[model samples]
Target: MTTDTELKKEIAYNIRAALPKATSYEDYRKLVLALAESGDTTGDKTVSYINYTLLNNRRMKRWDKTLKITDEQMKGIKAFSGKVIWLVLTESWCGDAAHTIPAMNKIAELNPGIDLKILQRDEHPKLMDHFLTNGARSIPKLIMLDANSLEVKGEWGPRPAVAGKMVAHYKKEHGKLTAEFREELQNWYNKDKGQETFNELITLLALENVGNSANL
Candidate 1:
């Protein structure tokens, strides 16, 4: 069970190592939002390819091999009384799903107290529809929820456009998610000028220049 600081440190290292040109928090935030939209809808490959090109380095891929779960470390997260639940709603064939699930697993391994569940969007149409519309239920929905209240703490994706729209819409309609983690991401977005953030936003969606919401 790595401490939140340790986990955040590692995630930050991965973000930096990704060498995303995103310099400010908003720049980075939008970059991720765009990538998610393109990846989910058009099977956009630009951002995904860049991710592979960058983080797929031999050393970085090694991070995957080193990821592990230990009972003791898991127990250390007992202080997370927030009833953390990671809801991964995705498809087996999704490229974005492939990228995200591994990251989710890494996070889960690091935080043992979080309850994680993997659900296929097609199989759980009802759950998928809750956040989607117009027959556009996308894949790779990553939602961190509070089980006791059955409320979402933070959520990301249906992969690309709808996913980004969903978050913004959710914030607009219901108000923003208040989790500290989401705020940290917001901090990353606000720290830089807008360009780096835009590119990184696309990269996070896994489509980059491959395609965009227009195709959907």
Candidate 2:
């Protein structure tokens, strides 16, 4: 379990490092509730990510990447000239990354007009330059673009001019997402609840929650 001190420091670092749009306390509340609702009895983090994402949001997984946009989908995206792009830089093992990628898939499901992509941060270090250099290196940045004009519209956190908003909001409202929260979130990632509600959410998010499911 992470200590409160460590959690405080990381939360502070996240505030300093990221720039997210000033989300309504509603957004944070839903996010936290979704995470809390997603936890597993077995104390596993991976299972939690899958369950939380499915229950609360949507996203998809690619071959090696737990959360990604498929090649066939990319081909369809690039074919057009002016399209909005929502790209997330992530890797499956990353804690934040695990949360993010699947969320994108869910977004895609809700709004087919938008386009989504997932890039591995380690594989493409250059991508990090776009969001945040901070070591927090939170995974799964949400990038958006105008589908018709193909201009970038928005993104989630850690970018220049972006971290300020997240900082301003969290400073006033969040009071640091506690270690207990992280612990609970981590718990959701473990074990097999095997509930259909959880599985359906995984499918909507395009997440491979069941590695065994892939075998079939």
Model 1 spans > 4 angstroms off: 1-63, 66-81, 133-135, 159-216
Model 1 over residues 131-189: C-alpha lDDT tens digits?
55345675666655555543445556643453355456666876765555344433432
Each model's Cα RMSD: 18.9, 17.2
Q: Report lDDT (Cα) of residue 98, candidate 2.
A: 39
TM-score of each: 0.39, 0.37
Candidate 2 off by > 4 Å: 1-83, 133-136, 147-150, 158-181, 187-216
Q: Tell me the lDDT of candidate 2.
A: 0.42
lDDT score of residue 11 within candidate 2:
41
Model 1 weakest 10-residue run by lDDT: 19-28
Best by lDDT: 1
